[model samples]
Target: MKISATILAAATLGSLFAAPALAQETLNFGIISTESSQNLKQEWVPFLAEMEKQTGFKIKAFFAPDYAGIIEGMRFNKVQVAWFGNKSAMEAVDRAEGEIFVQSVDAEGNPGYWSHLLVHKDSTLNSVQDVLKNAAELTFSNGDPNSTSGFLVPGYYVFAQNGVDDPKKIFKRVINANHETNAMAVANKQVDVSTNNSENLRLVQARQPEKFANIKVIWTSPLIPADPIVWRKDMPKDAKDKIKTFFLTYGVAAPGKSQDQVKKEVETLAGLQWAPFKPSSNDQLLPIRQLELFKNRNKIAGDANMSETDKKAKLAEIDAKLADLTKRMAALK
Candidate 1:
């Protein structure tokens, strides 16, 4: 009787302990909806499935409505791994203890992409400076405020030259949307000008040649860091290693002629090719860190619509925070 009772108690304790352990083994993956959700599911889904096969773990992807949501999901530990643009990746590194695991290399195997200022082929808009010079009379399209090439660099280029807060004050109106939408808007003649990444435009040209032919890039910004694949610092070491290994090896298999057809449908960006991913250090985010400071102080606060007093006050507060955050980010190096 004594033995029976002891055995029963031990079994109960074992089951209780096993519950949490079992739950922790399940993997959660995440990707940002910077592109359409349908596109993510259709194209990236297979890449993840292949990763799952290689790693021998069940991989489930969580798609966020926007970039900010994905960054927040990483912060709260709901998702274990994510893909982020340079600007949002910096935010993730700051807020979520995130570490970059890999970045997409070009077809030539280089890790860089550029920002492009796009206009209809027949439009007279010559340069970013020219657009700002005649701001109010022309129409403009911008990527979502959180976008890297779409918003950050383009906004900085215009504001830095104009020496003003709101570029819209000069333009008839500033339209904010996704890069693809902006490209489409410009091609359709819905807006006179817009900005997008070089890689995205390549994809557009490859997939929709006719539409892309109607648009041309009038200016290009300096290279932005390649988009990064990141993982939560808190994720298990073993799991992180497995994920890193899988992405690093994913593109190694050579595609046959038939595979070329598939590649055409899967990849939209021209130079972008799947290379093994490397873990990116937050150090790469330094440039964007500076850009963020400039944006908050000048762009956000300097909205021409806001009163001068309000703008100055907001700028002061942002300056203080940026100074402190910059110090901390530097310290991490």
Candidate 2:
């Protein structure tokens, strides 16, 4: 049957666009590598397998080398869904228009973790103050700038409150590493002091007990928000719903799987998954954003290019705003 040229062109274009709408081909999930990338891929096999079975989409991982990599990937739409640290997730939400759908809980099913500043077991440093006092004499390592416990919590709770001009500058030298590397650095005495997390320290303990045991947590920050599972806000609604269901229902029983069997699967990734989790919103990161704002304000105060008069005026303005935020946060109780 001959068709009109206009109709033929319309049909061809429709098919081209409709192909994806008809079949959900692949889900590109971005994961920031806190540990070794190889281990992450391997540990994810069971979870990914179940996700694929439930969602009917071939899942491919975008294993980013650092926290910023995944954030940037989501910003450019190279990543549709991602597992992100709280601070990194905040970055994704702010810069990539990402939304938080769920958060991970601990082994005890609590949605939080500790931010720790670590020192060698044999080191004389006894507290965060010790590190600050010896800042000019010691080397330091901060977690990825976007990490929650690694950078955000410690950056605010430890370094910022200490009145240190810059944690990076106070230390004789500064380096950036992931949680695992930071723990190992403290263990090996490669860095005099480093920021880490209780959960990541536990992970290292599981994989290398000796190294983990040698590193001691000198200071611990108050409970911080757990890592969040995020997806691009522009993702298809149906896909987002399905993905949410996959997480909310994971480790639950299926036709052939026993509840205990499912429990074991989630247990294997203790620090990564939360079997009984709750949906979250962008507001989960308000405190984190506030911290970043304070950090930026401090940087402005230390601006060498600004005239002394201007710098003092800016500092006064920032301090007033910060005081208001502090009061509001306290009132949240």
Say which candidate scores most in lDDT.
2
- TM-score of predicted structure 2: 0.85
Per-candidate count of clashing residue pairs (backbone under 3 Å): 9, 0
For candidate 2, what is the lDDT?
Answer: 0.77
Q: How do the predictions measure up, each by TM-score?
A: 0.77, 0.85
Residue pairs of candidate 1 with colliding backbone atoms: 100-280, 101-278, 101-279, 107-271, 135-170, 135-171, 136-170, 203-268, 248-276
Query: lDDT score of model 1?
Result: 0.70
Instruction: Give the distance in Å from residue 286's predicted Cα in candidate 2 to where it truly belongs.
Output: 0.9
Give candidate 2's total backbone clashes. Answer: 0
Deviating ranges (above 4 Å) for candidate 1: 1-25, 253-272, 297-333
